[model samples]
Target chain A: MSALRRVVRAFPSLLRVGLAEMVAYRAEVIVWILTSTLPLVMLAVWDRVAQDGAVQGFGQGDFARYFAVALVVRQLTGTWVVWELNQQIRTGSLSAALLKPTHPLAWFAAESLATMPIRAVVLIPLIAVIALWRPEMGVGFEPANAPAFVLSVLLAFGVHFLVQTIFGCLAFWLDQSLGLFNVWFAVWALFSGYIAPIALMPDGLRAAVEWLPFRALLGIPVEIGAGLATGPAVWSGLLVQLSWLASCAVLAAFVWRRGVLRYGAVGA
Target chain B: MSGRAFRAILAQWRAAWMAALQYRSNFLADTLVTALWVGWTIVPLWFVFHRAPERLAGWSYDESLLVTGFFMMLQGVLEALIEPNLRGLVEHVRHGTLDFVLLKPVDSQVLVSFGRVVPAKAMLSVGGLVVVLVGIARLPVAPDLGALLVAPVLLMAGLAALYGLWLLVVSTSFWFVRVDNLSYLLTSILDAGRWPMGLYRPALRAILTFVVPVGIMTTWPALALRGLMRPTDVAVSLTIAATMLVTSRLVWRRAVASYTSASS
Candidate 1:
């Protein structure tokens, strides 16, 4: 309750700083958005492949909708805080955060949230393009599913942020967490549908990826957005997401406390 | 032209080496990171071959491995030399540190291009070479000595092409200081080079080979390993690399001449 109160108190300042930083990096943000055209390239390739015959369950139109939604979903759920936190901890700049009254997680969350407004600007055009190019492909924003979808997105963000923080905290124990982060990212890229849909994976791998948290982080929201999943699958996926979120949140908080202690002892 | 310039270059290299030594642990981590990246490339081939153990895009699994191995080697070289040095050009240009670099008696371009040598990345390059050698040994049709000879030449051309591309991007900082993220754009495009260019659509293949020229950096060396290089492809790749290098040099000179530091 006290942590929540502190976050509430510091939220405005955090948002202000985040917005300023976002504005300062506006050109970079634009370039980042533009550089996310990999999904579009994949979409083109898959669509061509499905031009003559469907690949498994995906037709050309399905490929278009899948990749387009995947792109948007990736943008929404992306968390690069691991890189920031790792750099800060390694350089001992995280001490600055420890001195703050508010929890560091609150500050990071605020910064991540602040970037959403700018992201919405990029997302709007992408939505327009999707609407124009593939209007028939939507999963339908049903009233019942809307709340669940929103909840899933939030839970996904929680998992992503917490996992990144865990990796960041590894810097206290290890010399550099970048290699671990790279390995994790490679797993995420392959299993999380960042490169391709988990559904498109070979049966055994698809089954394995489905059980993993990576798919819950990226693919589920995409699947929800595409209206490909519903009912029990949605609830079960949400349950899994929440479970992972809770576990990661606990792990991150625990590791962070210990890591900070170590940093203090080492006088870095 | 002067002995002083040579001394300055050597001094810079020594300084970079000493700095890298201070964080020796990071060297191991970076090497592991490169190894993981190399592993990432091989996984896709494993899956592709598991599905159909013959070939992809008209090349056997071993050939694909050759492509990936050569690309990794070339990428290691770029990261070791050009990337670490010129990556900071935007920050230097923004902060007016370029003036200090310019005031030196040495050729600024050469200095800027080789200012920092990432020791960890040099290790990664050695790793990439080992991967290439192992891959060659496993090939059904053994590569001849000529292929091995041409490999380094092609790799050098590829590295020059990449450095030229990066220099062009870095020079944009003179006009737009916010283009630091342009390196991210370059890396993402290079990621596409991990696969054979033949797998892409004709238009995309053309763009990757000619416009981006990533195919020349990665695929040509792999093709050489397979003894598939026609004289025409070799000539075109060399021409492209040379053209890009000259063009980037011209652009760099012009950008520097026109640069009015942000501090002013």
Candidate 2:
């Protein structure tokens, strides 16, 4: 209870620091954002493929919309927390963080959240230009879906951060959790619709991936924001996101607790 | 190409080999990572092909695998050699560690380029070859012998161009100080290499073939394997490799000359 209160009390300062840090590294952040433009590449290939005809109900415009929104979702949710955590843990600089009055994860979470306002500032104008030019992607921006889309993106971000925290916690036991995270990343890239829309997946694969956290963390917001999902689908998607957000939060806390006990600060 | 340079490079490899041998257990983990990555490489093709009822941009699924295999080989080469060396060069520049290299009595470029070797990454290249062979086996006709011969040479041209590109990017760190993620833009281009060049729009195809030449680097080799390449492309690729290598060398020298040490 006290830890929770302390984190809440400290969050404004933590967020200010995070936002300042992100702003200082703004150029790097933009470059980092641009580096994940694999979806746009996939968008090109798929757009070309769809030019032949709509394949699995996706026309060129649909792909443009899906990928554009997917890019937004990725930029919003992605954080370097795993690398930050893994480095700190491996180098034992995590001890410096451990000495803080509040939990370290709170600061990490603050940093992740801090990237948003700046990213949005960058994203909004791009979104405007893209929407103005290719207005087909302008779907689901209606007030009806806006709140749901917002919530889904936030939950997705939560799930993604917590998942990364869990993986970063693996560094407590494994020598290079980054390798393990690479495996996770590759799988995530496929299942998360980063490479291609999960809608286009074969039925069996889609069925299987639906239960996984990857899609919940990435695809649902894209789907919602792109208007691929309707009223019932939106509610169900939010429910799934909430469940994932809750479960991953628990899992991350559990992993951290267990992992921190094993922290002998080998580097220290 | 000289005997002493060859021996010096050989010694670097020997040290790399012994260092890898010292951590034998990492072999299993490295192999596992390679296996998973290879799966990531192949699985996306399945999804894209599943949607395409017929050939995807004039290439069959089996045929596309050839491109994927070639792409993987280039990727392995990047991960194994170019990325590590150039990334090290960036750090060396940032921290002024290049002074040691400048002091060394050899071609600074050659030493920096070939100094680091990740022997464990050999598995990724081997994995790529296995996929290429598999794709070859599934082909309607055997890949022609002449084509096979040209494939490796073309692949070297591709690799040389990529290495040149990386060197050029590293050279920019002399001014930019932190251009780390800039290299990933090249990587994103390489990621697009998995698909057949025909799959890209004409403008993109032209860009990939002429401007960036990722098509030449990855796709041309696969096309050569299937006896689909124009003889003219081979010349173009070689020209590109030579141009890139020469240009990168000129740029690197200029950058080196202008370099004020970042550290005292």
Q: What C-alpha lDDT do the candidate models reach, one value each?
A: 0.77, 0.85
Write the residue-wise lDDT of candidate 2 on A153-238 in tens digits. Answer: 98898898988999999999984589878778888998988888888998999999999988887889988888888789999999
**Where does model 2 sit among the CAPRI classes?**
medium
The number of the candidate with the highest TM-score is 2
lDDT of 2 at A256: 94
Question: Worst lDDT window (10 residues) for model 2 chain B?
Answer: B27-36
Q: Which portions of model 2 show Cα errors greater than 4 Å?
A: A121-135, A139-143, A266-268, B262-264
In order, the interface RMSDs are 3.3, 1.4
Which one is best on DockQ?
Answer: 2
Interface DockQ of candidate 1 = 0.32
Pairs that collide in candidate 1 are none
